[model samples]
Target: MSYVWTLGEQFEGKLRGVSFELLARGKKLAEELDTKVCSLILGHNISDEDLEELIQRGADEVYFVDDPRLADFQNETYSNVISDLINQYHPHIVLAAATTIGRVVMPYVAIKVNTGLTADCTQLEIQPETKLLLQTRPAIGGNIMATIKTPDHMPQMATVRPKSSRPLDKDPSRSGKIQRIVLKDELVDTRAKVIEFRTDDAGFVNIEEADVVVAGGKGLKQAANVKLVEDLAKQLDGVVGASRQAIDRGWLSYPHQVGLSGKTISATLLLTAGISGSIQYLAGIKTCENIVAINNDPEANIFGVSDFGIVGDLFEVLPLLTQKLAQAKK
Candidate 1:
């Protein structure tokens, strides 16, 4: 049977949250196409419980490659293995997270399999009549959203944005087949070797995973004023995000940037201070549940998408808002 395949991602022997998110999306597309949803993962010493969790989430089948060499992500070895599997199994569609590993490996695999790939896709749907995968993503620097399809390719491919969708609740009764794949020496061997992995100690919460994000923009005027944004985020037990302008000014690190070229977030509450929402900035936060904008201009673009708007000087408004929230907690 044709399958909607999702490439599962693992880090340090644990599956990343995006893996389950892809499975959820894959399940929907699979149902629309009348196919099964399959998950493929490559790692070293991954537990059977984790493999079973894939089934519980949404995967109807799980294929995993377990080897010490597969633990750290190597571009050539991973791409070759995935490409070979696609050629052998001939899945109807393939989905992967648009992460660092997925970004590096998927293009190579798509080229090897001779298929087009849509990167950073925000939405996916199966065309009713043709069963083609419709990949929707921001185009022209996030000014427009384009829907693309690979009509000629055997297996359609897409790298979905992380946090763009939530995972299905785990169902303990769900059952699926689990298969272990053993590859030849040549497929697992690669010239490139990972010397060591270094983690950045930036001392900031991962905004993509944050439930609440307080963002600042150019209107903050100076880097010192960014502390207000940080303070408010702390009050809400959340992380701080920034517009591209704030990042450009060196007020915040690139990791804190939210926009077309930066990270996409799906926070429950996104509070923006002094940000005039550009289309690029809006695209990143479109999935947020509630948006509150604090800007002096009543016609600020941010107010248009905001659930609540405060038209006043954020310099004055933020301190009072922060004080009130703190008092409420006390």
Candidate 2:
């Protein structure tokens, strides 16, 4: 009846990184609140295979709904299951990853439950006075961090981007109970058909998975300079990401852009070359473990978040860094 946090488990045959990330956060939140943490897993007859790993992820209890309709991720079907589960159990706080599936389903679930959600949040805290969720996200790019809340909601919901939060040290010793939830006919519907599932090659080192990412902004000055960043990334064995400006300038594709309106990534190490680190750009990639900033402008905002900074022309610095890291590797 009284749980501090509920993790929305996203299963792709196995538990995802975001799911473990949420569990790690939930475990911390639950300890702070002196309450239990639970995870919601929905799939068709996956109770035996899926629920055990969730238990190992620091969950006090795993609430599972085994149904045929949940075989694939259908927005309506997924949202309905989540919405119904929330109404039935009524947990205090719900946290979902801002992954593509979560992006599609969380808002719908929140709207269905008539609750406000903080989208693409980077930080989360609890109000010490009232023990309420303080959801913080990037506003107007990555320039400003905004904390939000829903005053008139039962279970506060927040959707966090991947790698924003660190996962807990895995403990196979942590064990819990798995409760199978029975889904009735009302929860079953067919608005769509999933004929073929094609895995889109997420491409060279998914920026989200990269320990280090080298990103370029409009300051590259010309489309040709994007290759400089790419070459550097190749040397560093890191992925190449860009600001929306670079993509809009036709220097890069939308998939490579990192910003409020772009892909969200948090790497252990991130390098910003020629980028101004506008708030929107920061909104997407600010949670990096270590940031290296390179720009000619000494007043650039990237210096604020970067662990190390190089104030020099990128054209000079990139090739040198690339060559230096390359030589060191050999």
Candidate 3:
């Protein structure tokens, strides 16, 4: 009866970007199954302002659980609370954002609830014949795609990677119902404790939400030349990305790095500079709508998969292309 989506905490009571995307996708799946889209917002002392907005976005019902002591994140407490909510709703499907919190909590909840959980799913569909949730994920080191289903489970559970699915277009006029669920404060507190936290200036851009991405790889000779990649991305009004090698060398932020060891993105226009397009890198970005690759090597592996291929040194080509685009804009 319920397609429940979990919304994680951000700055204060704010919703993370990926949480909205999950709600939009959950709305679609709910509509397909003729069920209501219910969102479970978890955090300590979340404002009604936040809960009300989630209902407006797409959720048919909002379940808010709040406590002042629960402000800081401790995996055990949060997961236990969410699991309790699932038990009450008995939802048919449960979706979580494949974020650091969701990733840790989902696996734990799945094992506790005795259900199968799919992590980093790029695609999801309800099978017409069986009504089984067909969850798709990158398999075999991102070389192949695998679709999995838990036939005997009541509420199908899965965590989807951020930016893989776009959020529903905001409709301020949209209306829905909000239902605050009972929280077992005693149980949740006893289950977990928060000692301290560490914050890193990972980045400002939610690269997953970017419509276009320009990424650089190992071919760009030196760390100083990484600026070329950023310039091109800026020209396109898109985010900049890098390959595993670039990140490993401390040339780019870990969040900006794309490959097996990093995040996955499905931007509309993915422009690659100097990247050789290794299978691992492609695994993260294969879902892009239009891919443009530039490499000096005519026989680069990137050419085999790129929709548009340009053979040239990225140092020479990137500046020219950025200038051309800038002039066109002017």
RMSD of each: 2.3, 3.3, 2.5
lDDT of 3 by residue, 1-330 (tens): 456565545546677777678888888888888888878776666667777677767888887776655566677777788778778768888888887777898898898788999988989988999877899997776677899998998678999877787777777787787776666765465655566765567454566657899999888878898899889988999988999988888887788888677767778899999899788887788777789999999998888879999999888899999999999999
Model 3 clashing residue pairs (backbone) = none
TM-score of each: 0.90, 0.83, 0.89
Better of 1 and 2 by lDDT: 1
lDDT of 2 by residue, 103-138 (tens): 888899988988888897878777888888888987
Clashing pairs in 2: 141-279, 141-280, 142-279, 142-280, 142-283, 143-279
Greater TM-score among 2 and 3 belongs to: 3
Off by over 4 Å in 2: 9-11, 44-51, 142-144, 194-210, 219-227, 234-237, 297-301
Computed on alpha carbons, the lDDT of every model, listed in order, comes to: 0.91, 0.79, 0.80
Q: Candidate 1 or 3, higher TM-score?
A: 1
